[model samples]
Target chain A: MSGFDVGGRLKQLRMQRDLSQRELAKRAGVTNSTISLIEQNSVSPSVSSLKKILDALPVTISEFFAGEEVSREQVFYRASELTEIGDGVLSWRLIGARRPNRRMSILHERYPPGADTGEDMLEHDGEEGGVIISGTIELTVNGEVQLLTAGDAYYFDSRLPHRFRNVSDSECIIVSANNPPSFSDGGDAQHHA
Target chain B: MSGFDVGGRLKQLRMQRDLSQRELAKRAGVTNSTISLIEQNSVSPSVSSLKKILDALPVTISEFFAGEEVSREQVFYRASELTEIGDGVLSWRLIGARRPNRRMSILHERYPPGADTGEDMLEHDGEEGGVIISGTIELTVNGEVQLLTAGDAYYFDSRLPHRFRNVSDSECIIVSANNPPSFSDGGDAQHHA
Candidate 1:
């Protein structure tokens, strides 16, 4: 919520996408000066204004706050360090932020009581798989949707669009992995473990 | 080194490759009964014999011992749980194991002085990148070899038949991840992490 923190994250996100100030300003319908000022920490963006810019960038709000609460073991990441993304119903935590020289990015996702990714199926260009640690999640790939409970696993080609939802009232936790490890928020990743 | 552990891992690796006892035995230049006995814990093969079988499978010894340690956290994996892979020279450990439902796998790898993955290069079907944590490693992709030191990173397609080696006597450590998380040692799931 601090302008400095927001600006820092904003700058990181923008740099990651290889965006220039003028280009981002044009896309977000803001003045170049405004974008520059916000990035320089000279001005704080209102929640709505920030949301607008993020929407234009198409970055999820939850992803904006995903890198906090580092672990103490200096080896293992603490749960508190996990940044929660998405709504309270369906959220994801990026694990091991303090880890330097990381090769793959890891995420811990939680599906709320009766929450789901979406009704539409999704597909992408990566290898996806994971183990269900708890609760229940209904996943549909292609024309078939399978109800996976604890201990079950699914590995699939990510190019196919899929949908996921929590069938149980309690929260569902799933451990998932995608190959090629794109660690940003975009439509390229599928939500199933 | 125990007979029980080796027998179990052999069976798991076989299943991962979808090979039956008879098929594996034939390819391994051993009798079917011998393979069956080894898997059932009836007999332990000598080191040479086991190595022969492993070579036929084209897997490394490091993969077999990768998951030997157990984690102390409820769902969190301890850094101690990681196992060193590749002779005494090059080693790797898993970090994305805490919650298996995420889309990426994280690994910590180390290389010894003058240790190399050998001259043969490897190219995979997934995208890969990692930061160098310590020491230095000479990474060769296709015909290009880049000497990378701490904090440097490179991402490339796995199909390049790349090889990495450490030219120094001091050990080098790197955190790397591959799409789909292929077990270079095979699928022992050693629980080392």
Candidate 2:
């Protein structure tokens, strides 16, 4: 679960749905070799390719990552149990790891001073909302810049080109949530395609 | 913020957007009287009507209920601070009330033994997903019946006719979340129209 076992997970899901590799490839509008390479972990499928495959299975991106066997009794998640993703100056603490069937991805995120999402900006499907927990961050959504301080919240469709940066000389904290969880590392704009 | 001050909240949002009641009514495709009655707190708007109004404002139902003045610094909510909305054998503990511009409504719900949502099934716009925390419950979604137990989860489009009942002798607990929060009390199916 630490590293994204996309191949293993995809194979599992495909089998679970009783879909053959050729069948899945046809359904996903991809070549058989593409599915084969993905299943064999020989190639990293682009975000678009992965999305097409998942859509063919009729499973969401969040469900694809939740894995096949999810515990039924596990409810509350402790702060320590949060799955930490992202690196460098940005940190994302994701709630409810190993919990199945998540519709939303709730993240307690932090960006160190001067940290930025990069020059490329970010784009994805679904909607994103967050409350600025502490410090200040400059948010640019589709060329509109807004300086959001602690207590200020923002909601926007993720399809817009958006980027976040800690404009202040202090670490910024944000309680962000996204519907139909965008499973991309924020650095790559291509991940959104 | 404790009670659903939908009327006051709608008026505030309408004014904030610099839209008159007539303008909002026109955009929402409802009669001006409908908007007036909703804002005056004289009539409870149906889900469809409320959705139309919110869509005209281009805000999600979750954002509408997050209220006008949401503080950015208010990130964490203690268990005691959860807003209790449902009555009778059903109780819903809603999280992140003071945080503004919410896109999702996360709830910790409880249903006592023999409790049911009612004879009439519920339907609404948006998607819902929940994990059964404890005990057993029977879920009927669009004529399909599912007996879900602890750790089991359900996710479906809220527009599907759905109902839930605690079939076991013990109390049932569910941690549920919905995109674009359904503000209506579940007992009234008329609210859906």
Local distance difference test values of all predictions, in order = 0.57, 0.66
Q: Could you give candidate 2's per-residue lDDT for residues A12-115 as a string of tens digits?
A: 77886789999999998988899898888777665456667877875544445432332242334444555677576588766553444444666667889998
Candidate that scores best on DockQ:
2
Q: How accurate locally is residue A181 in candidate 2, as Cα lDDT from 0 to 100?
A: 61
What is residue B97's positional error in candidate 1, in angstroms? 16
TM-score of every model? Answer: 0.34, 0.38
Compared with the true structure, what per-residue lDDT tens digits does model 1 show for residues B15-114?
Answer: 7677888888888787788778777767656434554566566443333433333322122233454434545545666544444333345566667788
> Across residues B62-128, which tens digit of lDDT does each residue of candidate 2 receive?
4454323322333334345556776766887665543333456666678899989888998754566
Which candidate wins on TM-score? 2
Question: After best superposition, candidate 2 residue A118: deviation in angstroms?
Answer: 19
Candidate 2: share of reference interface contacts reproduced: 0.02
Task: Give the lDDT of residue B168 in candidate 2.
Answer: 87
